[model samples]
Target: MRLYFFSGLTTSCNTLKFDSLKLHNETSNHVTSNNITDESYWYYKNSVDGLWRRWDISVNSETNVAAWKMKWLNQEPKNILGVIVYLTSVRELPQLNISLLSLRQNLFKPRPIVIFHEGDFNNVNVQLALATTLGTNIPISFEHIRFPTKISIKSKIGDLRLGYNHMCKFFAIMLPYHPLISSTFTFYLRLDYHSYLLGPPLTYDLFDHMQINQFQYAFLMVSTDELKFVRELWVLFQEFLNDSCIKPSSAVKKTQITAATGLYSQAVVFNNFEVSNGSLWRNEPRIHAWLRKVDNAQGIYMYRWGDAPIRTLAVTQFLDDNQVVKFRDIGYFHRREYTCSSRMHSCSIPSYHRLASHIVYREGCHP
Candidate 1:
């Protein structure tokens, strides 16, 4: 397996001490020889040294910025398919600007951007103009998705009307039912309007790995010990999957993830395998109809279920951990929490990315 690192950094962001990993497209100082690693790499290792300690980037005598661009940024991968975002409120416009700008300036090649928002296109256009000024040149299309007026979630607190942001998660899942995506497609990367790409744009190779592994979904796994709601959310997630007629798979069990402790947070990548043909996400009417029932059903609000953990649980029903990959090097920050190692940050160019601090509740993930 080849170990790919991100580049472009002036210094370490936050406490991340290492800075040699940054991939600078303009300078060859970060470029290393292709005579790197030839061994298979497993993402999850229980070593205190962290994967960064083992990363070996050999310095070469001469720099080839053009070749470096060709290898990492010049060509776009076909497997990316498309990128989607669900923006529910106008308040998110500011965050949208930052996210889109980072994407436009950093993404290797332009990919289709589909924005689903309830706000008027006028404001969206304004934001787009700002993003363009920031560097967005990719083709973007927008669709108006109405926010659900009522919440079926019956809470002991009262008739719960989960905010529009929470509702956005449901709309996000509606992708499999959409006309453009097909059962045989490769993969589609989904991002919340607030989530931005901080490393080199993802490529077809990662998607191909997911396809070969038969992964239906991929997400960033959160340490259950760090989240208070993991147990309750997992219980409700299991209930939803059970009601939806999803089956448990051993792959999920291999990770020692229980109904009470599994959690995959932030950016989701859906593969065409089970997601396209299986009963879970692929079952549009059946699952959505079931969701309506659950939404209205009472007693579930005790856990205050969230879409991130819920979707993570749902995927476990049909696929195993083997099919899924929890990325730590992508260098992402939600509100503030950073998942990448110091070496990973070394790859990030600060002008194009921000250092993440402690992770906070994503817009709709918490009360």
Candidate 2:
């Protein structure tokens, strides 16, 4: 087993050991090939009985599209371009307005905005106010999140008070398959209501940059999640890999296996400021199947599993290192974590806020 040292503390992977004996015993019945040396084959052979079984969840294209009620405030953009998505509620309207203002000021060009809300957004005045803030040139759409009866009924976890868990599932699993996004946009950027872009105007369109560079995923910051939320997640992911006969890329396998030895406390992409290629999730069959498996596990509600870690797993498992890019020129702030280019004079947050060990700094910035 490999050892990982973090912050002057040495931790062994064996600290959170998997039940090897149990796994061996469970797979003893399967015939092994004398010359087969592939570890993924063994993982497939050792699949536990009911851990990653298929569920009745309807995650197909048609069913996913029917799950939301979408309305456009203005005519849809005639040309298909990238989109900016915000999953917000009425309580966050003030912050949402500020976020839009920042986007208008910093973004190089006007892109469409799609706002997702849980309940009815029938208030005409509120819609008008949001449209006015976004400016008339930007296409705006409001989508009402209609939780599927099948998925909601299966969420047995009792912590339904704030609906945060629902948000996790929506962003992690459902957003990519939404009809408006899947059919139109080449890429999508997720910026939470509290997230802000705080620097000089972007020198180029971010979406065009991603497409030109052939980047599938991009992020501004990286951080770790609390252990409690992801305790069983790694094991479940392993089971899914084994049962589904999916071999992760070499980089993913190396890092995830090492991190799993601990408790997955290594770096996770801070998804609130994430930009992704829409086709990666929408067109990939293996990714779609993996998403269904995760959704069926009900961990979103059971343990308050956030989308950042979940997306991190997906990125590592399915995408290559070259496909992922780290943004340096854009200054960003969300919650208490922030990162900015050294040349950014207009960044509102102090430089000290970006000192956390987990935050990824631009090339020359010192922590």
Task: Tell me, by lDDT, which candidate is best.
Answer: 2
Candidate 1 structure quality by residue, lDDT tens digits, 160-227? 54553345334324444332232223355566656665655444334455557665455543433225
Query: What's the distance in Å from true for residue 260, model 2?
Result: 11
Model 1 reaches what TM-score against the true structure?
0.55
Task: State the C-alpha lDDT per candidate.
Answer: 0.40, 0.63
- State candidate 2's TM-score: 0.73
Model 1, residue 150: distance off in Å is: 3.7
lDDT of 2 by residue, 7-62 (tens): 11112233333232111212112223323243221111111121111111243333
CA RMSD per model (angstroms): 20.1, 13.4
Model 1 poorest ten-residue lDDT run = 3-12
Which parts of model 1 have CA positions greater than 4 angstroms off? 1-80, 127-137, 151-153, 157-161, 168-175, 180-186, 200-214, 225-248, 251-280, 283-303, 341-367
For candidate 2, give the lDDT. 0.63
